[model samples]
Target: MKIVVVSDTHIPKRAQRLPSRLLHELRSADQIIHAGDWQSLEVYEQLKQYAPVNGVFGNTDNEDIIRVFPDKKIVNVNGFKIGIIHGHGKKMTTVKRAFTAFNQPIDCIVFGHSHIPYLKYKNKTLMFNPGSATDKRKAPFYSFGILTMSDELHAQHIFFKSK
Candidate 1:
């Protein structure tokens, strides 16, 4: 299965739309996961065009988003257990979040909030962050991620140069 992971879009505050590169990546993905801080329903709607999307509300999101999205969730894909969260607590880093989720029977943890794209392996679980799709503060950057699942699951972060 191919899963696209993204987060912290912040939308109008960062860019006018999702980068074309991200859209292209999503088009080929089997599923989509948005970590949070979407900032608008339009973002969610836009993502839906690429693939089926599941997401949670970030600290910056409004009540409507909170009501619509769960704070955390678990998805079973092709026999692999995947956990998703926005990572807003004190231990917000990927490693920390992965460790916290280690208690669960999950094979991977996907999260975002700091707007930095990263992939790490903790013990047996893969941890991933898709960065900010709106290029919030770091460089003229935006990105999305792809999780490749087979016998061994792997994560690849794809960056988008802001246009």
Candidate 2:
């Protein structure tokens, strides 16, 4: 299975449209996971047009988004348990959510909201954050991520230079 992950796309505020490069990956990906702060329903619709999308609502997201998404979601993709959450509150809060909300055996945790991409593993848990797609700070970069599963899982962070 192949999945594209992105977050913090504060559309219309940060960027008018997604990078053309990202759109190409979206078309090729089997699934897309959006971590949050989407800022517009159109963003979601555009993503869905490319592939199936799994998303979580961020703190900045509206009530309609909240109602549609749980604070945490567990998805099984080709036997890999992937946990999705828009990390809110504090650092500890998100850590706690990972332990309590995701009780099942998980292969990875995908989260957003610091607007900084991170990939780390402690013990066996893989934690990933794709950063802000419409980054207002730090080199004006937009990014997303990709996870590929075959014999094992492979992940990469993709950064795009905004012109």
Candidate 3:
């Protein structure tokens, strides 16, 4: 499966729309995952044009978004259990919160909040943060994530200097 992962769009607050590069990437995605901070339903509607999307809602999301999605969720794809969260709160770091959000076994965790691209292994689970496609914050590049599944799972960040 070709999964495109993104988060913290912040919509018109951060940018008027999804980055053009991100839209281009979405064209080839088999599935899309948004970690959170969508801020508007328009983002979801936009992503649905490419592929089925599953995600969590962040602290910045409005009632409409929260009503449609949870604060955390487990998405099953090709038998791989992936945990998704916004990774926001008052305790610990964003990664730490995501690492412990789920009480069950998960092959990977996709989360965002700090707008920093991160990919690493914690314990036995893969921790992935696609950063901010619209708001890179202090990161050098705007970024997203891609997950390829076959005999094994592979994940990589798609970074670009321009939007």
> In candidate 3, which residue ranges exceed 4 Å CA deviation?
none
lDDT for each of the candidates?
Answer: 0.81, 0.81, 0.93
Residue runs of model 1 more than 4 Å from their true location after superposition = 91-94
Q: List the residue pairs that clash in candidate 3.
A: none
- Per-residue CA lDDT of model 3 for 1-163, tens digit only, reads 9999999999989899888899999999999999999999999999999999999999999999999999999988998999999999988999999998999999999999999999999998999999888888788899999998876778999999877
Candidate 1: tens digits of C-alpha lDDT, residues 13-120: 777888877877877888999888988889988888878998888888998788889888888888998888888877555558645854677788888877777787
**Per-model TM against the reference:** 0.90, 0.90, 0.98
Give Cα distance to truth, residue 63, candidate 3, Å: 0.4
Query: Model 2 over residues 1-163: C-alpha lDDT tens digits?
Result: 7899998888878889888878888888999999888878888989999889999888888887777767778888887888898888755755555544566678889988878777887458788888876773674567789988876877788887862
- In what order do the candidates fall by lDDT, top score first? 3, 2, 1
- lDDT of model 3 at residue 22? 93
Give the winner by TM-score: 2 or 3: 3
How many steric overlaps are in each model, in order?
0, 0, 0
